[model samples]
Target: MTDSALAPIDALLRTHIAEYPGFPTPGVLFRDITPLLRDAAALRTVIQHWKTLIPEGIEYIVGTEARGFVLGAPLAYEIGAGFIPVRKAGKLPGNPAGLSYDLEYGSARIEIPENSLPAGARTLVVDDLLATGGTAAATLELVRRFDVEVLGATFLIELAGLAGRDQLPGVPLTAVWTIQD
Candidate 1:
């Protein structure tokens, strides 16, 4: 579906997202997006909405490992751009540049191959959610190490009170849905 035709995207997100309170920890409410992924209409709306947020002329779409991979690949195909996967520590086959950061519950690392993209390639980063912004910031740093310009970062949803966007100053970020604390 065309980007403009995705006006119902917000409703689709609300319908399919599952809320799990105290998940992975006490006092933490996790907004699970797996339900949205399972629903064909919600999934399509998410991709289309995010595609609309991406500015034109992006050469590469970089997605963090795991969940990012699922969203980024289709977005890359839809926008006719190249896809680059930023994987976890030691998961990448080649010598990769890695960045370490703290998540809400624990610390984690993300890696990207040194040669994933040519120098100065424009890249758009995609992820399933934006919580504390640690992962997103690390991914951005990893992309910068390759000398690629980060066009923007896109997410299916954002937890507003977490202030994730503060960590990504000067980088464009777009979310189809946001949960206010």
Candidate 2:
């Protein structure tokens, strides 16, 4: 859907996110989606809207560790696609392919289980938030290791002030809501 078409859902989503000032660190504002997840109506609305945003024929949804799992899994089920979980280092069992990257706040590593997808499967990377795009970019890199076709990426919210999109060139990115932070 176009930005204008998604305005209603985006407006409703804004109300679902809780804002915290100076959380997890000083001088950092946190937008929490716990409230969104707790509300059945809101969650359903988001999932339905995402269905329209996601491309047709996506073979799998690659969710980033943690929040992405919450959103991606259901969306995958809704769209009849498989779900792949990308995790932080050491979180995956067995021999997983790993990649290290820098975050806006610090540095971290992400990993995906090796041979998780059949070669040439198409996928969409998903997460709850897009900040500096470090994690998303790293997750995309990890997804590439599987020799799959990355269709695009989607997020629940985007901190536009951070310009995370710049970190992900040549990839179609969609966010349910965008706010300056």
Q: Best by TM-score, which number? A: 2
Minimal lDDT window, size 10, model 1:
1-10
Per-candidate local distance difference test: 0.86, 0.90
Give the Å error, residue 150, model 2: 0.4
TM per prediction:
0.92, 0.95
Q: After superposition, how far is residue 69 of candidate 1 from its true place, in Å?
A: 0.8
Tens digits of per-residue lDDT, candidate 1, 19-66, equal: 999998998888777897788776886787678777899999999888
Segments in model 2 whose C-alpha atoms lie over 4 Å from true places: 1-4
Candidate 1: stretches off by over 4 Å: 1-7
lDDT, residue 143, candidate 2: 90
Model 1: C-alpha RMSD to truth? Answer: 2.7
